[model samples]
Target: MSLVVSSINLKIYFMKTFLAITALVSFQLAAGQKTIELKDFNSLSVGSDTKITMVKSSQNKLVINSSDDDDLSIVNEGGFLKLNGGEDLEITLYYKDGLESISADADAEVWGKDEIKAKELSITASADAKIELVLNVKKLNTTISSDAMVTLTGKAENHNAVVSSDADFKGEDLLTENTNILLSSDGTAAISVKGIVDANVSNDALLKVYGNPKKVNEITSTDGHIKIVR
Candidate 1:
């Protein structure tokens, strides 16, 4: 009786182990890649950047090709195209549709092509997320709430930026008049720009402007530093 009982216990253990393995395989198969598309949207909002890029296409279609299809989502809400991606992957983008505006939020890393053209652009970054965009636009606005980073290149009519925590901003060729550029840093922010700059800075932040200031404000930095180079 003892031998029989031992044999039965051993068999039960093997059966349970086999069942667990089978369940794991089924789950892996179910989590395969998925594909999705949208026909019409005026703007874009992405939660995070998983190695995404925009390319000019011949057709008027917005395509998102993901490395892991199951980890990407695209939605159209209120005439806006919203995108979200998984933690450590990338999604490629192809678009010719006339998108008017674009925004990145919720701790996302967004990278654009070298010559992305738009009417308006905005970025609200926090939680260590970063955005590197090279765009030709009319207006650009950026807000950094936490320890995030943003870098912008290309030409623009107006550039407005605010950094409140340990955030940073780097602007290249961000051409605008003295009256149209506003850059403010409330904390230990690091800001760099290569255009005519007029700014008000505070705290232990650093602002570097590589152009002239025609109408200067009382640019105050309580415990900060502001540097300008022609």
Candidate 2:
């Protein structure tokens, strides 16, 4: 009887110890931040409900700050980085090189930390996506649709934007030599131009232009409105 009781007590103690260790490991993984090394990539595509902060860095790296690091998919495919993130996954990607293009979709929010310097940059966003970026580029191109919103600042030599499907772009702070913008389907934009503006607004869309421009050619239809102010 004494031997059997001692054996049972030992078993219980081991079980309790095992449970405690497992709980501790789970808590550590939940609370700890993970760092991942990355290769240099030119373009990035983000999907799902992830929030990312992109900033310039001396080396390429990714830091997973929230949730499990393994749950987020980060892959470099042919000089392009594709990130498929979950609703709770938050990460910061630091890159050494200038990014050429970015595509954001499906509730992803991307914020740029510092000035993005590139020869040319292209951005496309849709479906509740949001982007805030500052660029110093020769040429910039953007396409926004489906309730997405983009805010742009900094300087570009030339800019072309196509906005539709209730999207919004606030870009009055971007100093540009030339701007060509088209808006349809209740889209709206505010821009600043220094040289020339060719604007076409239709289908209840609205455009507001700022800064002193050398020339302006604007066309509006279907209750569309265009306003240019100093």
Candidate 3:
């Protein structure tokens, strides 16, 4: 009976020590992976010039982290999160709490080195924002109000664009079911669509469509060109 009691005590002691070490390691990891919460927000919106990347993870929280986290400001405004930063910032956005959509209205540059998976995305690129997105989403909608340069690639179900200035929009390998464009003024679009295209372009704005377009309508441009490929 004494030997049995000694064995049980030894086992309990080892279990306690193991738990202590495990807790220590967990604390260290949590400290290393410092993240800022996007609290009280269901969607993400950026109003300043910033660079953003989406991280694909199973965690359900919208958290952002950067190497230099001091100059960044993330605010929640009426159930939406807005991002603002200074200098060249590499921002990683993780949608851990079921973030559904993204909207950006600033003159920011978006690099395609990271991939974003979402249900919907809308970008209003004014003031000549150099925008590029490599995404896997259901719908992609964009509006260009200035001479912004935009590029979009990846797999999506639907794509819609509206250009109102002397901007250039390009898409490569953007396999989608439906593509729609409404261009005004000196806007130009060169895109590759896998399905159908419907465009109403006017006033020296050009539209180019490549892929099997089942239906096309009103693709007109005065002093501009409309090119289509099967």
Error of 1 at 215 (Å): 3.7
Over 1-230, each residue of candidate 3 has an lDDT whose tens digit, in order, gives: 99999999999999999999999988876654556555555676665677776665554244333345677677777777777773466566655534555555567665544577778877667776776767777888878777887777787789898987888888756677788889889898876766678889888888878776777776675765677865
**Tens-digit lDDT track of model 1 for 69-186:** 5666678777777777745654545566466665666666767665767777666677667777777777777777567777776676666777767777776445554323334444
Better of 2 and 3 by lDDT: 2
Best-performing candidate as measured by TM-score: 2
Would you list the clashing residue pairs of candidate 2?
Answer: none
Provide TM-scores for the models. 0.69, 0.85, 0.70
Better candidate by lDDT, 1 or 2: 2
The residue pairs in collision within model 3 are 60-96, 60-97, 61-96, 61-97
Candidate 3 stretches with Cα past 4 Å from truth are 1-34, 60-71, 97-99, 112-115
lDDT of each residue in 1-230, candidate 2, tens digit only: 99999999999999999999999998887677777888779998888887889879999888887545565778886788888765676688888867899988898889995999999999999998999998899999999999999998999999999999999998999899999999999999999999999999999999999988899999999999998786
Model 1: clashing residue pairs?
50-90
Looking at candidate 3, what is the lDDT of residue 75? 79
Candidate 1 is scored at a TM of 0.69
- State which candidate has the highest lDDT: 2
How do the candidates rank by lDDT, highest first? 2, 3, 1
Candidate 1 stretches greater than 4 Å from native: 1-35, 58-68, 179-196
Q: Which candidate do you rate higher for TM-score, 1 or 2?
A: 2
